[model samples]
Target: MTAPLSRYERVARKVQADGRVPALSVALHRADREPWAFTVGESGNAAHPLGPETRFRIGSVTKTFTAVLVMQARDEGLIDLDKPVSAYLDVPAHGDATLRRLLSHTAGYQREPYGDVWDTLITPDAAKLVAELDRAERVLPNARRFHYSNLGLAVLGQLVAKVRGGTWEQVLDEYVLTPLGLRATTVTTPRQAAIGYVVDAYSDAARPEPPIELAGVAPAAQLWSTASDMAKWAAFLASPERIDPDGRVLAAATLDEMRWPLTTTDETLWGAGFGLGLILVPEGRRVVHVGHDGAMPGFLAGVYGRRGGEGNPGALGCAVLGSSGGAGQINELVHELLRLAVELDPAEIRPWRIAPPAPTAYRSVLGRWWSEGSEFVFAWHDGRLEARLADAPADRPPAVFAPLPDRPDVLRTVSGRETGELLRLTRDDSGEVVRMHWATYRFRRFQDGFDGGPASAGPEPVPAG
Candidate 1:
């Protein structure tokens, strides 16, 4: 988006003032605009101001990275989403939890690894985690509901290590960090890391929080990164089709699968949902923000991305990291940045241009057809034969069809209405399409009753292209 930097800076400054955070770093990324980053608050050193490159622990946002790793394993045919994770790892408890459940927080695994790890700040290593698996309880039945569980993801990390024959950290570095050039995102503490703090409830005093090693459960929440790196990572999550065209990490189709909402995070409001590993938040019509939010003892982060709405918001990403923990401001700030970018200045609209005509076979079927008492408009758009109800919502996608190989008259609805159903075309002796059947329902150029009677004559079809 072409959103003004001053506008973002104003929001950043306001968020910093409202939270009284020690340090706040925000970054925005769009394909057509230069990356924009803003940092405000104390930098300790006057010579070096805190900036986007300064690392802050991202806590549960690391779950998103781990989720990608599991998807990669699936892409390589090493893991199956439907199979029980025990099919890969011989964990003592919750062996029946499927990989999909684990990824989507539907596994019913308890919130943690059977201990007060958060209170003690004493996370176990991989070995200890597996040995004590029996201690972890299944709080809910498998696939019961969306119960956020770090333990579930921790076990998945081990699953990746087991199937890949390496440590989770090592496998992650080799598979994701190194490949994505996310050198700043790592388990080890970086020299430029920002110290986290717990601001006093009554006073303005901020006490530094201790940094603990999440050795065993690190996959769920251990990595540290700057807003800049995380913004690009968020961009990849939302628009893998544009960012990772090579599919080195995961295919665009796999990313599509990941974005599909499976469980709602908020039961009452239904405002947000959980995808495979991503959190899906609907912003508005045809625009859903995909990413994750994280918080630890002293640090909080919000990293999210919104795909190009056919250029209205053109592949956008934002990351907001704060040094103070328990501050909802950090997460809200990131979302505000995204909203401002989309509303203030989306990508400039491209002038309409023309190319390539519809195929001869589809030309006859491309017009207006009536089916089930509804008028449908058909046309070849974006190289696909698509149809939609006359009164369909503007935001709803049309039913797009692809011809079956060697079956000239048959087409499959790959997406939109009646998906996976077939559209069969009937031809007359003159090679003109007479009528059609979609999803076993008859469609005709003229409105007709099912009882072999004319209902009413509608408008005539336009001449074929």
Candidate 2:
């Protein structure tokens, strides 16, 4: 074990001692540095201890990699995210659901492949898998809610294969693993793979299970990888510059498009739905990718990479590979590891606070102004003026505004990151506080000749007290 392994080993031991998992491996990588790997516990038979080279079936973590390939294809104009999967595949799904919906789990397909195929070790091939799509049940409208569906990703994989003209496994190998130099990563079979084990719920015995062979749903959860390989994969996400692999996988702009939130799942959380095969978790100033991969009876794994920039200085990331079926536990361990790494190497602080705004000589600027094409009614909230989008659905929160430092006439969105200036109020010949200009839009108080007309074409001036 390397020096870095000491901290990770402590985490692995805690997991093993807690009896959550029998054997586990962890890897960590910093930008522009060699990856470190650590392992604990023995294989199913307890005959040998686990090592960095030991491969575990990474369940949903494969989705992140798959998402990348899809985004790469999109960058090359080989596939369109807005188009329906039926546009590429020979089979059709419930509605005109597009690939974007499928990536975000909004497609409403049944949680798993449409059947009892997973109960037995028998998995369907791409053709057989597509045939089952006809019977797939749509639970919710497209883009309704965050519903995780394995079938959705399986469909995405099929679409990638169709667009790229090869198997899902082949596409991943050629596009991602080969470029990243992941030697121990693949969709492996039992003959040349680590045997998975499950702790008998009723007993302390560890029962061996066959390797999960997911030819049809390979894009969903069929990836097999070691901690070392995953560490490199994590680094690529943390700091793209360190491992872009000839810039063929995904352009920075396209990757940013993937990271941008198409819709808000929660107040503080947003996701792109699907971009380059990864599930994005937005953490205020930064973003993180929580990848999933696993199967019953044998293995469960998770890989997460915190979004680089802003708060993440070195762009740190960690990978957890555990053979026991405790997927949730593995996820927790990785989170803890990341917390420690960030504390140890804190990112440079960027102060968002501005100097206090000066007291304004004019009080005319304070008044009700109607926002165009917005349901939000501008009013005061918690001692500060705000605009609550009235048309904003019950789930959508309102935007708040507060005075900026040294600029009393300008108000920015305090609740979210949106910044805008509050234009000074001007009175017409009638001596009424009529017009207020902001962000190129002129606002008239209430109904004072406010024709809802377009403002001047020239750039709007900055707010001055």
Candidate 3:
């Protein structure tokens, strides 16, 4: 018997009908709450009603899992993102394309192996795959643009296999899936799984798609998962630290690196971009989503979560699974649910609290100053010295500095436009700061009617107390 319809159930029904898919499932997750899931329509030729436990091939979403292993290898100092993959693997010469480029699909690798691998539903083994590397030519120069390449991820998988001394499947289970408690996500299709189909373009009829087993290229698109397990995965992606407090799976900062944009899919559409094995979807100026979409011969999947950049524990996610290929409605449905989640209840903003008092020496550096007639301010936050244009937006990051361990007065810009530059404080005979030089610009205390403008170079007067 069908269960009572929930809000999510209604949306899932609409999505299945609109996409003309044989079966569809959706899940929504939020922090500190149980996930809401719904499944509608039939599975395979049996007309069996689909349920939340029914697994479906997650396709290229597997790349994100492979990416996590690569990142873990990097954390262990076994791999370098800037170095060429050839330095670590025994693949054909790929010029100077780096590991970072491969993960971002900017390495310009051939989209697939030689011959009719896609049509034949056959992929080469490791030896056969490497032997054909010479035929895998670069379609464009490295970092030319956002190009999708399944071959690059397959190479990454091989690297993981080599470094861990285990199969890619085993390493993933040890490093990611097991740690996250995603029991239903497996490399092989489960017994209770949805049958993939290709819907006819001009009619309501559809044809079952023969399952293709990805041998060497399993890293590209070969994982099946249920909505119940995917909900847990989505929650982890939404906020890894909260979900994995022990950092057993991946470090919080490294996860942020994966979300950083490497390139844009379309130049005109700035809202859509690609990160390291992940997709970036901009909701507004403040909220950005980081996840991946997947599609194979007949299955489609999407997983997205809000990435709250600023100390905001932005925790919300949506996952969708469909049993039809080329439905072209998965992304739309996922986006709608994401928007709805945000609209219903926004992320909480923590209350402001006072930071520990600055050191006696650093206390003197706090307050407003003028640089080239432009107002600027230097203040202490969490024991660090940060400066920014006085008129800058409140939410924007500022140029932060750290005191040189050897020389307390000499500060180094750690982040922002002046990163890596030195800031030497100029003090008067009385040891009161008169002016300061950062890079090539000098800043002096702003005083009444001090229209001294910008001093290209000069010994500015110390502000009178």
Candidate 4:
């Protein structure tokens, strides 16, 4: 056998060839191993071979970075997501749109700023972008639907600058890029970058696209990132719990909040969704990709990391960047590579080993219990106490409980079905857990009926008989 990950290169090669792009660079990052990367085609420079470090404009993927910055600002009590921009900065119009609404693309703001800047190839500076806000249209009611607004994100970037007391680029560099060790992701195109091009449709020719500066809209669509840097970034977005356990760059819990779906991207198909500036594509019910697809005039990129699917949780990210073509091939390449890595070279399974059992006090809470006439099994697994319906599917997660800091008798359901609820354990004189109430419903050794007696204790023992 050739070995795991050997096939990944071949698949990427096929995509690059079929995509007919001038250059395509890709990277795969898993928690367990060193990052894997390669590039195919040319870097538009005869002297420089297109490689992993060759930067490509990531376009709207910049929004995800801005989103993370906004989240960090919120985390540090710099801003409230629910509050309107007017609460933070003075804007001519639409200052009432909330940060959360802007991030989720539900602020009902128009897609772009007031002018046909794209046609003119002229972009505004931060001040002009805001000052011209009066001309921008609020096409729908607040929070009406998913209407993407690059203008809204540009405004948010300005908000970040205003609150952080730095330019958006400077703030992003200090807060995110530097902290995450993303040296190659920058606001300006570097010398060692692939020239973005629009490939000819009917022939084997390509024309280089003119360099466009986003200026004020840079927060929405202005970033040049190498595949290696973006793959790690994508991984961070998907599994910050593993990539950033210490909460250095961004808290893992906050990332979780960002991934929570706000609205479906394709309403009829229910295929993809937008979440706090991230595009969430559910590959299946189990494996969801949390990242964003990016496109400028001549470049396309797809960067994503996996969550809730089979594979090494650590190695859950892939980035594909192309110098030409629509983003379809680049995006398809990432998904395909991710699948190959997981399928051909799945993570090694850890052997079960003997370890300390559940905490001593929770020992009595282990085993089977009946609640609301339904059979449930409570067990101590991996040092925590968990409860689940006896009939729950093998793959279904159980309700895991964490002990309340002040209340020794109470445990909160931290995750699984009855989340945010309490489990109150009742102990007898011996201090053994005799029964419990989960989410305020009683649990017993025997099935308990809603009326408060054992489900099996039939009708007062058939008094008539």
Index of the highest-TM-score prediction:
4
Worst 10 residues of 2 by lDDT: 356-365
- Rate residue 123 of model 4 by lDDT: 90
lDDT, model 3? 0.81
TM-score rank order: 4, 1, 3, 2
Inter-residue clash pairs, candidate 3: none
lDDT of 1 by residue, 1-465 (tens): 234788999999999999988899999988788888989987443455687678888999999999999999999999999999779877787799999999999999899986899889898999899888889999999988899999999999988888999999999999988887888898998878888899998999988899898999998999999898898898889887667879888898888899989999878988999999899988767888899999988899999998535454455889999999967899998888988886777788877789699989888998899977789999998898999998888778899999899997999998889989999999999889988999999999877888645686545889999
Tell me each candidate's TM-score. 0.94, 0.71, 0.86, 0.95
The TM-score measured for candidate 1 stands at 0.94
- Model 3 shows how many backbone clashes? 0
RMSD of each: 4.9, 10.5, 5.2, 2.3
Backbone clashes for every candidate come to 1, 21, 0, 4
Candidate 2, residues 191-298, lDDT tens digits: the string is 334567777777778777765577788888877788777877776765666567457666655655665545544535344333435555544444455443345556
Query: Backbone clash tally for model 2?
Result: 21
Which ten-residue region of model 3 has the weakest summed lDDT?
1-10
By the lDDT metric, which is better: model 1 or model 2? 1
lDDT of each: 0.88, 0.67, 0.81, 0.87
